[model samples]
Target chain A: MAEERQQGHKWTMIVDLDKCTGCQACVVACHAENNVPSPSEDEIIRGRANHWIRIERYWEGEYPNVKARFLPVFCQQCGNAPCEPVCPVYASYHSVEENLNVQVYNRCVGTRYCGNNCPYRVRIFNFWAPHFDPPLEQQLNPDVTVRGPGVMEKCTFCIQRIRRAREQANVEGRPLEDGEVQPACVQSCPTDALIFGDKWDENSRVAKMIPHERQFKLLEHLGTEPAVYYLKGGETHVGE
Target chain B: MRRLASLSLRQRLILGVAVVGAGALLVALLAIVIAQTSAADEQPLAFSHKTHAQNGIQCQFCHTGVAKGPVAGIPSVEKCMGCHTYIATDSPEIQKLQGYWERQEPIPWKRVNIQPSYVYFNHSSHVAAGVSCGSCHGAVAEMTVAKPVVEMNMGFCLDCHAEQENKDALWDCTVCHR
Candidate 1:
């Protein structure tokens, strides 16, 4: 039981929104790393674009007191994931080893039940075979698959790269270093706003960030126990 | 004999034609294989690697990003003129390099060693681990047309990695998979 519990390490991320300049580096990095297809303009207008990590814009109040907030959202990989229970084919389930919500593309029949159940609307469906134009396709990271049509897809937290890093560490007979493994989003963030690590590790950065007063999860009222948390933005700047 | 003679002449002709077509197809397939093997020997350019390497140009100069990224990129024509602009302006090969640069079209260098898209090999990691370029590329500095001498099969990669001297870099499926 102890070994099983140890194996089920919860991986989490805390994005400090205050530090985020809305540069979209994380968005581009995620796309490059995971091979997320860029949808046509028509599809984007219909909100069918597949962005694994998106910077959501929120507006509050009127002209004099107008305040804009940006939040980077992605697959929360919830402990009690709502998407998991709704998956009729068991395509979406939490992995026993990493506590990651693994989405098996081969198994997904595109029923989209999981997408509907997700309150955050992070899951993206491939209406067409995702393709990149010639030279652009060459730039794709071979680690991840380019999903075909009729399959539901979402973030896997770059599990393929993680698996690679872990295997390398094992070969060397040493524990994984702190910054040895970084997802594309975390790696590309210019301001270091996104911090990813093993949440189960008491000394991990994620574990330390989660307890801060400014940290909170989206739709936490539903008891989803999301692995992702956001640090609230700093005080608004006004004409002095 | 009377019953055999009752068979339609057209039906007998059709059977004879089908057998002849099958025979012709088999012969054509063998010829194609022989042609391909012979065609593989043709070289488009007879560039020498030994002379360039001897001039103190590192392998990474022509194969840019080999030490920093996933791809060991074929250097653009502009990169060639960085030194050749002053060193060998009169040479025919240098003139060819300059002409391609003026046109802004890259040289379509033939890939002697190509891996399938599924395999994720990072030159940076391998180079950092002290694996020489010759280990997989087969003494590129000695070749003229960069012919692939080593067959980069899974077994070959495993065997090299399993060497006691290279035990630290030994086989991991994810190393190449991801």
Candidate 2:
């Protein structure tokens, strides 16, 4: 289902589930780079935890030969996002240039409509004030905002890094080259399970990888065209 | 409902008046805070931009980082001594500069323009876009003690950003808020 992409860049990500070790380097990298709030151990179960990208673990089969399947779920940057139209405040909108779904922090009034309408359940509400303990507070990334309570936030695909890379490319009087802008997750992947690039460019890796037999979009039947593409693992049922 | 019923009309009136009065007081105090945040905070040495600018000294001469980075960095004491060594040795300001240089200390220059903690401003990007210092700071060459002549508010920034000629693709909230 290849279609013509929008001008400038159509950003996309490809995650090979087969190669994922689930070491969660991407998780730690995202936390460090994006200033995800650190809720205390007790607050975590109370629905006050914050994670822009979360690894969903689904256990398969009984305990004898059980296996945990990990799915790293974040905002899909959907082409027809359910979250967008539901936002009465117009805080959640799409960025055409990068094919990104961005949240306007100041404009968001914490209505939680966008969160409710999201099918992927990627949107996490700030149930309480975001915090970082003593020394961790000093480690907050200056490039990313420590979003206040009463705002619903999700993964922006590291918009700060994208803007910076674009600025540099513009200053140099050249188009952004392939593999130029790596999101925090893509950069930290030890197994190179994740790849990010402008799908508009024919030569880009993501564009080339899109049509592979193993490639699939999460909830494709729902018709929400996600920027993220995942590859199925080669494993089969234990008795099969 | 029961709690309100327990109070007489006079008591309610007094409470209403107090709420409005407190609200107004709070608003007034916020205005003062905002005013002083951008107020031409008195620098330690009372450096005059008017005199230096009139003498054909560029804004970049002292604020070297303006064109290349996030901050328009303040001039080091050594930079002042670089010219004050020969130019104005007898002047009081020059003597002050000399003293800081001898002490090997940096001059803690008060900022004329202030950005809130939430705002992420890039000086290099603005400079590259051909924006003049006066566009935001007002006429730097004309000011004696440089204060924030322009109100650096979100609306102020968005107006410039959404302009037809200056319309950048980066009107995204994360562009500035982060």
Candidate 3:
């Protein structure tokens, strides 16, 4: 029983805001990897687009001397997740093995309570039945389920990839190596903006980068203790 | 319709009972057919596991992916022809298999047992964990045609997983759900 209580690796992601260009590569990669359907133009206009990750751009300084700051935001995978408890059906819960928030699509009754409770506003409710046109259906990832209508989903930090990595590691009779599991967002980031690894591992890139002076959680004061950390962006700004 | 309406209340009651009885009988017959179909779906070739097992062939020889991947893969037509080339050239099933190989068309064998798409069941993990094929698949060696011996459901899976020493990882929903 005590062995079961032991928390394994703390999977964390450190996003270097300085490196982000708001290119939306990570966003596109996420949609492709997770089988998230692209919403219709009208649906997107109505704010029904299901982007697991999105670049939040903020304008700095006056219009004449304006600087664009890109902040890529997704599910933070909080240690004390607000969404977990609010899920009436226990669909949105933290996995003990993975140390990440998991959303069981089959169990979710779509109360949207988890989406509402999320401070990061990462949980997305499936407002309509997903439509994949023609050849697009063939590209759906078999590892990840194509979530149906009336289910709440969010960025899982690519839990399917994590599971695959772990299974391979388990079969090989070795502990999971650092940087072994790369999420779709991390893999697609052209500027190396998203860094993902086990923070518990002292040698991991995330562990080494996590102690930077600019490092801050999304909502530190709210006490969410999010796994994702962002580096402050002002230092790299030109023409200061 | 008018003649039926003109019948006595007692006669009408008897007619109603007779119609209900016939409907129930028809439903029962349909259910039996469905149950049989699910147990052993129609296969292109009537492959018998008993004959193969009795001939000293191992299950792993045909199902090469059973211990390696998520699925216990169906053997290719080439794999079948490898043995059928010299073993049983006269057999009708062997001839049918040869026809598929000649045409280079895959035999669309209907799966007898299948889990829901949502459930991420891995054959390798279970095999590595020392689960016998018969545990979930029943005694295929004795079965002439493949049939679902056990219901592949959450409760059926949990029954064995609960017995394992490490309950945390096994019990976690994401272990199978995600």
Candidate 4:
């Protein structure tokens, strides 16, 4: 089905690494949008944490020349998703129409096999039930469910937003226009680092960015065909 | 279980039967209590759908957000009083409505029917598709208290969705249960 849509829209995300300021606005926006739950400080220390999108910080250079680099890691929505087939219950799979990785939360039996199989390591296991500190519960977006414990959850490319957009578009009897359905990360990126659009549309920003000589997938050598693309950093050093 | 090893075979069989019988009885009683509590029969006012429908009132007139938002919003106290202030000043129901209006306090209506958290049923989408209030809701025009006429389970949803005309965009698990 993705191949059939070769001339049609293929949902893809392009992240311009050069544009990322490491502000982690995208990460915070994702948590706010997706009800991904906040584990307590002790749980975070125990290596139990929940962030659908996490900014991986790396320090480069030495002796005052050191600079922290940020790479926001989320579900790549791989074309050949390694996390799909290994799912004993088919909870995580690719959507033919969306051309994006889809997770059926209710179907997930929490086998954690998908977590083990994901090459991106973006998949996370909900070790315990999610708890909200009083008023924080009011801030939750009702469109997304507060996933219960014992279910493996991860970035769905903010599929709830996509679903709403698509449904609205259908009701209006029109094909999705360019820049219509933005995943939470893309929408909240203050630096314009994340651009989500149909890659098949030649005029779309993602299509234009995908061909840049510096563009690369996280684990291209693994042949996972990650839907997320990254633009190589500029020659200038960050935090200078 | 290990302590029961010392008991005779006959005695062990009897214990197993007794434990199973008690468990079944407990389960049955729990089901009844759950059913009774969740019937959606009681409301702050004796709001009768039959009377409203007979008086030519549309469901959307009260539940204003049914076609625009996720929730089919309950009518506000002010919305109720807007008509009742002049129309039914002598009626007991109107008096109750006026009491709330005078106090400016919202009624705490008990929740009636709702899908599990997993099922993300959007009211706008269904309403826009021209599905009637009486579709999943049954013959609501004939009912007084809005008790659930259908179980409204996955099977119930699937049965209607399985029809050819209403089949599109309905099958996927992500379609409903996000």
Candidate with best lDDT: 3
DockQ metric for all predictions: 0.10, 0.42, 0.65, 0.45
Model 4: CA > 4 A from native = A1-3, A6-9, A236-240, B1-32, B35-38, B164-168
Segments of candidate 3 deviating more than 4 angstroms: A1-5, A236-240, B1-39
Cα displacement (Å) at residue A207, model 4: 2.6
What lDDT is reached at residue B145 by model 2?
82
* CA error at residue A67 for candidate 2, angstroms: 3.0
What is the per-candidate TM-score for chain B?
A: 0.74, 0.77, 0.80, 0.77
- Per-residue lDDT of model 4, residues A1-240, tens digit only: 244454224688888888888998888888889887777799879877778888888888997898777888899999898999999888897776667777888889999988899877888898878888888799998888788889988988877887888777766667777888898888888889899988887788787776777778898999888888888775663332
The models' CA-based lDDT, in order, is 0.77, 0.82, 0.88, 0.82
Candidate 2 structure quality by residue, lDDT tens digits, B12-130? 99999999999999999999998777555667787788999999999898889877666788877778878888997888878888888898888877667767666788887788888
lDDT of 2 by residue, A70-165 (tens): 888889999889999989888898776667888877678999999899889988888777778879999998877778889889998898898778
Per-residue lDDT of model 4, residues B41-116, tens digit only:
7688888889989999999999998887668898999888888889878999879888888998898777778688
Model 2, docking class: acceptable
lDDT of 1 by residue, A1-240 (tens): 122345535678888888888889989888888888777799999989899988888887899999777898899988889899989888786676667787877568999999999988999998888888777788987677677788888877778867667646654567766666688999999989899888777777787666877878999999888888888885842111
lDDT of 1 at B26: 90
Please report, as a residue range, the 10-residue window in candidate 1 chain A with the lowest summed lDDT.
A1-10
Candidate 1 vs candidate 3, TM-score winner: 3
The DockQ-derived docking category for candidate 4 is acceptable
Candidate 1 residue-wise lDDT, B1-178, digit = tens: 6865776899778866888999999999999987654553454434578889988888987888776666788767777778778977888877877787788878766666767554567776677677899889888787665677788877887786787453543443434543
